[model samples]
Target: MAYQTTLGWSLISSGIVTLILKVLPYDSLWWGLLLLVLGIAILYLRIS
Candidate 1:
């Protein structure tokens, strides 16, 4: 149950980040990659 909740929140947060990146005026590969890494770290921490 806890795992599912964490996963759901992570997914929602990632979705929002993606949406924000798309809405931004300029392309930012570095920022997107950084956010992706951060998201992965969050998930890893939650699992551990």
Candidate 2:
């Protein structure tokens, strides 16, 4: 996949996670951080 495509998908996934976090009442720093890290990992794997 192209760089833009991979980045787009990663952003979309990350946005979805953010949206879910926003929609839910539970607020925790770890969940957001974890999702961000997970997104970055996926992007790295895709690039490699």
Candidate 3:
């Protein structure tokens, strides 16, 4: 339950971040790449 809740919130927050980035008139490709890198870093931290 705890893990699922945490995962759900992470996904929700990620989506919110994506939406905010979209609305801010920034470059999509760079924002997406940045998000991808951040996601990978988060996963690496969690895995270790």
Q: Which candidate should be chosen as best, given lDDT against the real structure?
A: 3
Q: Whole-model lDDT, candidate 1?
A: 0.85
Ranked by TM-score, top first: 3, 1, 2
What tens-digit string does per-residue lDDT give for candidate 1 at 1-48? 999998999799878888888887667687798778987899799999
Ranking by lDDT: 3, 1, 2
TM-score of 3: 0.59
Count clashes in each candidate, considering only residues at least 3 apart in sequence or on different chains.
Answer: 0, 0, 0
What are the lDDT scores of the predictions, listed in order?
0.85, 0.81, 0.88
TM-score of each prediction = 0.59, 0.53, 0.59
Estimate the TM-score for candidate 2.
0.53
Give a tens-digit lDDT track for model 2, residues 1-48. 699998998799778877888776666577787777986898799999
Model 2, global lDDT: 0.81
Per-model RMSD to reference: 3.2, 3.4, 2.2
Task: Give the lowest summed-lDDT range of ten residues in model 1.
Answer: 22-31
* Leading candidate by TM-score: 3
